[model samples]
Target: MKRFLAYIHRLIFILFLVSLNGCKEKKANILPEVSVSNKQKKQVVYQVFTRLFGNTNSNNKPWGTLEENGVGKFNDFTDKALKEIKDLGVTHVWYTGVPHHNVITDYTKYGISNDDPDVVKGRAGSPYAVKDYYNVNPDLAVNIENRLQEFKALVDRTHLAGLQVIIDIVPNHVARNYQSLTNPKGVEDFGASDDKSKVYDVNNNFYYNPKETFKVPVWEPDYSPLGKENHLLEDHEFDENPAKWTGNGSQLSQPHANDWYETVKINYGISPDGKKDFEELPAGFENENYKKHAEFWNDKTVPNSWKKFKDIALYWIAFGVDGFRYDMAEMVPVEFWSYMNSNIKMKNPDAFLMAEVYNPNLYRDYIKKGKIDYLYDKVQLYDTLKHVMQGYGKTDNIPPIQEGLKDIEHHMLHFLENHDEQRIASIEFAGSAEKGKPAMVVSATISTSPTMLYFGQELGESAEEDAGFGKPSRTSIFDYIGVPHLQRWVNDKQFDGGQSTENEKALRDFYKRLLNVTINSSALAGNYQDIHLFNRKNTKNYNDKILSFVRWSADEKLIVVSNFDADTNQKFQLKIPQDIVTSWQLKTGSYLVKDELYDTFSSQFVIKNGEGTIAISLKALESVILKIQKI
Candidate 1:
């Protein structure tokens, strides 16, 4: 027994030495602000691809039409289905691809123009290339004429299920053919009244190239937009007498195939030289919230495109949308967001507004001046976690990331899977959904940020099948296909996971438990203290693969430890420092630390010397969010 104890002691000493050289060499020099008040539970958003969410068709043929593979309709989101989503702890549901985008479905009979096969990315079309602002996709309705009513019914049902609805607002661009056949009686379609002769004008909706005809991209052997329709649009050219700038800001008459070729860029009163020609945000508006910013714009005159989008957003808000997920928000302008988001908030004060922004430098400006509620943390949290999951990144980098964004952790939304990112279970990512458990635990609990989960993330859907327009890794956003795991959960509209395997069901259960805990935990939103460096410098057997942190509030406290290594169990002592124990006002006594995640493991800690020590052995890819109670 003495020899065994000696061996364990030597092992702990080795871990401490390696960590000291690796982690403590550069401890996080900064700390986040603390709120010693009562804690509020955080918000969680669930992103669902509207056209694919309820589709059970497994016939995933590449570039297939809606009839071939089938599409999920608005009616498919039954009350039971939505309740299942709400029960997963989602406060908001981002219904992607709800707007009317160009497609090859030939809705010409319903007065909707037939989109050219040359411009559409896939048979189902790209959602970002929105063709109509006032209409929902006709393909999503049982009767094409009643599409809007169907969508409205969805919104009403969503609210009835106690969930808010968030749809996409692509402000930076529109379809190459900007014709909204079903706009409100007084609403003019984009570019309908503009003078198309001018290249740049404040009133002009798009930048034009006079006398230049728009040419289609030369099709490659591997990719063809006109799949199985070789004879269709054999002319291979769109009849634009004066070609406009491409959606990606390419002024070329004919953009490369890689460009956002299906869409046209919206001119926000910015000249071709990138000079701002519009009214700037009033100085000191940075200190103001959405309500104040809305008041600022009440009497002010803005650019024409700004007014056009504001009206569009107002129309949606009136139509019962709770908020918007602005597509490529940074590409438009900060001032436009300030104007639009403030207006949206004015109508619905509690509306959720999130953006797909990646520039870290513009985060604060967008948050404060632009009136955005949440920004994607892809560059900082998601990217760092991705590298760490792949076994190349150091866990020490996480603290610095949180420190840098300490002031706005609440506004930063974290996620492991989204439509734009590779699936956590994909071979290109961690190769297994089990690998993301620790990452998900840390992501959902590390800070006060709102958490987001893409559909199928919980059930280990790896995007293994190539569903057209893109390769496997990310599920295709521009195709008629069904998600394998999500379809099983849908279970042909029962949504009871009747077809899920035991492993898949358990994976989903983990997500359900984790998310419910996150939305219910007061400590998650109250205070955050990184206890990693202390463990690395002082504790025995705590390595870089293990992360340690503490969250506390007036009534509740939690210590989170996650093991990132997937090969071996992490046996260590999670030591609570003297200052933290006193600061938390934890009384000196014995306590039971219960695992809130799985509720299967726990530890007994004896408090003394102004400190608390709990011995634990976390298994490979295991995590524990402990709830401490005096016993």
Candidate 2:
């Protein structure tokens, strides 16, 4: 009897040990709750056309000279100006047209060569046609000789004001006459050592039409170089022996009038027969991080063009520039990006690298393999939202896109108006600035992606000027012109909107509130679930014009709804599904719902039977962000 009792005791002790081990494994599998404040911060980019942002001149003449239009200087970005931008909740300032592009204005006195009028876009040339890779735009400086210093000062000032700086890097092409007077030691020009006798060489920087001499494009009847201004270099002739391929991949000796004739394409060792001359990335390289990618290229030899671009990017990174916006990135090879962007990350891991990749099919490849941080979400989100805004499409179309891009949603950058797109207030677009409010809300808060706001977008700047070489509807990036609405907000260097109209002021206030809320909202950086489909099926009087979604974190919960109806006021019951209610762990009770954007209104979110519902009314072109909290 004593032996049997001892055996039972031993068996019970082993069972206790087993249960303890099971508890340990269970605890190990549980994920720790992260606070909302601890989540990643969403980026808000404010893209400003540097030359036009602070220009107070309202004299927007067609093809106006620099002296006539009065360009904005680096000194124009005053402390007050930067503070106002920061107050608008902008994380980074993209200073477009900062590079030394080919311009009609002669800097020959400063040893800069004169750009032929036929090759330049306007008095202030297209920023994409970069003339000098190693210098800043001479026109943007108060003192031309000290332009680089002025830019450095502006960068430092911007940093002092707690904002990062971003600039353009036109990698796929260079100005028709590419020169780099300020290149650092031992650095050579792009095509200095290229064997011009050959049409395609692995080491050549540019692809040449060996026997074909370059000829200028046939001018259209209405358009001429510099708008037919009687400039000294407007002879309608450009000399290029062994003419290179046009920027848009036109193989003709003289490209079409509509082609990117002002710039020449850079060759990346890809043969004319569509075969790669350089080493290809091994399979499964797409899953590797930038560090591993960088290491892979450490001992490898790349094409000459790749090295030149990489050097230029690193030079800018060393010069205190925080990021780059690559123009026409998809035009270049993805392998080049993998090399360039990986090197950039190795230098500054936090560098904001965004590109203009319009092809949705190549989005993931560019992002994961190329190490690119963001691509313009123009074709999908922007087009759909624009259609909804124009009254031709329904909000129902948005959910499928969001669902489709769930894997790479954060890599997609959202914008309503850019330098390339028409203004929201333009007649060709929505015809009223108020129409952008709902779209703006949806664009900013729909995903965890970075939100970009054009400089004059807040103040309802209708691109109404017929600037030289630039027509109405889209703001002129190719000419020296002042933005009227932006100038009003400038208020003569005060950087205060004293000269703005009442409507403009209210519109700006709307943007201000929306942006500030976006950057600080932890819920926006967390998980997103679409309630639009559920609300459409369950709620009363909820139409396709009204869009709804839910976003939440460990601490905060948000229900965002926007009304696209320009003429109708909407009052409806917005419902949250039972699954989401259960996920949120909210018991049956009335919770206080407050609008984070506008504080004047508040509503109650009642949760009953594992479902949440709220009654809300939104006016025409209006939106609301309802925050739920336990009362």
Candidate 3:
């Protein structure tokens, strides 16, 4: 009996041990291989301004047809450029301004509007000034569906080369001379005026003066605000006004009246009478003339133009884009986006929707309330770049940048540059192009956001001009050949031209390394829990220079230290917690070294108790990343 009892006890103990081992293994696997959904994974986005990037083998001048200007053909972009981008291993390609329009001519061809003087002297109008949201720019392709299919083929090729595709969607206004002005699809769906009562008012039917109307102004601002209404007047005032102006005046007419900005207003509402109704909530319409324009957002059933928005959304996805970048999200209704999001997910969940939201205050709300999948993190990009270019200063309050990373899985679409903002390099370099390249590269890469690169960013097109309304002005940096020109100059000169020549190569490599780390390391892909800030006290001395932090998951850990200072080297030590000390490897640049390994660094370095501190001999405005891992 005693022997039998002993045998039973031994069997029970063995079972208990096996169960414990299984649980441990499950936990380990869970932490190491969290399935990164389409939304969660890091994306390398390449922005393309369609007209600027095509093969242009056809006899199209800058101002010619979309086919001539480089829209439909996938092979228009340079092989070298594509090779470099493919080499960089970009995950997605976002083409801006591919949608077609007849009313909105490319800038280079527009009969120069004197009123909107900021319109580039030799311009191709921006894609944002949409003639029709559903159609591709005829200049870009023939039939809308065909154009999209051709574009999708490019995306497939991109995928063949290992990348995805995202396109732009303008949720706001349509082109100045859209065919729908008289007979809108949504209005037709809502049952247009059976009485055939079309009221023609100079103020409502046509473009208007800026002072009287709220239509987003196209004319050069007569007076510019300096901080707070400090005005900067234009050198020459435009004679042609859009309000009183008629189609007979020119192909693209401005409202002749000087009272308001002339652009077709969107009507989000309808009266029971089947007449148009618009809404500007806080400010009701005082003038009968402006009431028709007010018909844009007045329909209660629609809720801020949502009903019509659904059709537009359907049109694009049907056109075949994997994702969309929603323009000016804050101004639009949040419920509309939320509704659209649910519908889009129902139809195609993988579709990406990135919102243009500037304020950090709205980040959480947009995600929670608006159902926005991704938003640009301007503050993070700005502060980090400032630190790298200038040095640490009191201006660097990193709380927002830090707080932003907390729920980044849903809230963050990391970006250094996009269409609406200044070029990342321009911000870092400012007037001296020489100093900008290296600092911009290092700061942009190490910030560690799901990076978005605007068109021409890789080669070096500075965001130097004012992105005026409608015009593809100088402020925009979608110039495709700009980089090629730089490449040519560099090859011809055989010199970095007194700039940090390595900046470009370093940036390219940094991106490659960062992406490899993101795709390969389970640590970066998992939840960014256990975040700690360390050795950042001397912010004033370094001003914009030094930033260091630690991010870890159950399976891995990393200590990222960066020097934003352009002039001096930053040295800092970390008192790592004893629990996480022993199993760590040091990664410098792209190379990984075991803590036990010894080597000479041009700068100083040491590790103790698994706590490694670095004294970097940084070059002018360079960024260094120390990737620590536990075995």
Can you write out model 1's per-residue Cα lDDT over 339-438, one digit (the tens) per residue?
9989988899988899977766678999999989899877778877887898887787787667667888889989999888899899999999998999
Candidate 2's error at 390, in angstroms?
Answer: 1.0
TM-score of each: 0.94, 0.94, 0.64
**Cα RMSD, each candidate:** 7.4, 13.2, 16.1
Q: Considering lDDT, which of the candidate structures 1 and 2 is the better prediction for this target?
A: 2
Q: Candidate 1 — which residues are off by over 4 angstroms?
A: 1-39
Q: Report model 3's TM-score to 2 decimal places.
A: 0.64
| Full-model lDDT, candidate 3 | 0.44
Per-residue lDDT tens digits for candidate 2, residues 376-449, read 88777887788788889778767766766778988999999999888999999989899899999999998889
Which window of 10 residues has the lowest lDDT sum in candidate 2?
23-32
* Clash-forming residue pairs, model 1: none
Q: How well is each residue in 1-631 modelled by candidate 3, as lDDT tens digits?
A: 2123334443543343344433312211111224444344455677766654543232323333223333323444434455556555467778777664332233333231122322211234446555545545544553333654666566666656566667776655444444332223444321122111222321132323433322223444453211122112222233333322222122123332322122244433333244434322233322222223223233433443455566667665765667788766764555455556656655566777787765555666666655567887554444345344443332234433444345554356665445664444465334333344444333333333456666545545454433222223223322222233233323422323223256555554555554445544444454332112323332223333444444444455544444444456644443333233332344323223222111223333355544445444444544444444332
Candidate 1: 10-residue stretch with minimal lDDT? 1-10
Of the candidates shown, which would achieve the greatest lDDT relative to the real structure? 2
Off by over 4 Å in 3: 1-40, 55-74, 78-83, 101-122, 142-149, 180-263, 269-304, 379-384, 387-396, 408-410, 425-449, 463-507, 527-533, 538-544, 572-617
Q: After superposition, how far is residue 180 of candidate 2 from its true place, in Å?
A: 0.8
Better of 1 and 3 by TM-score: 1
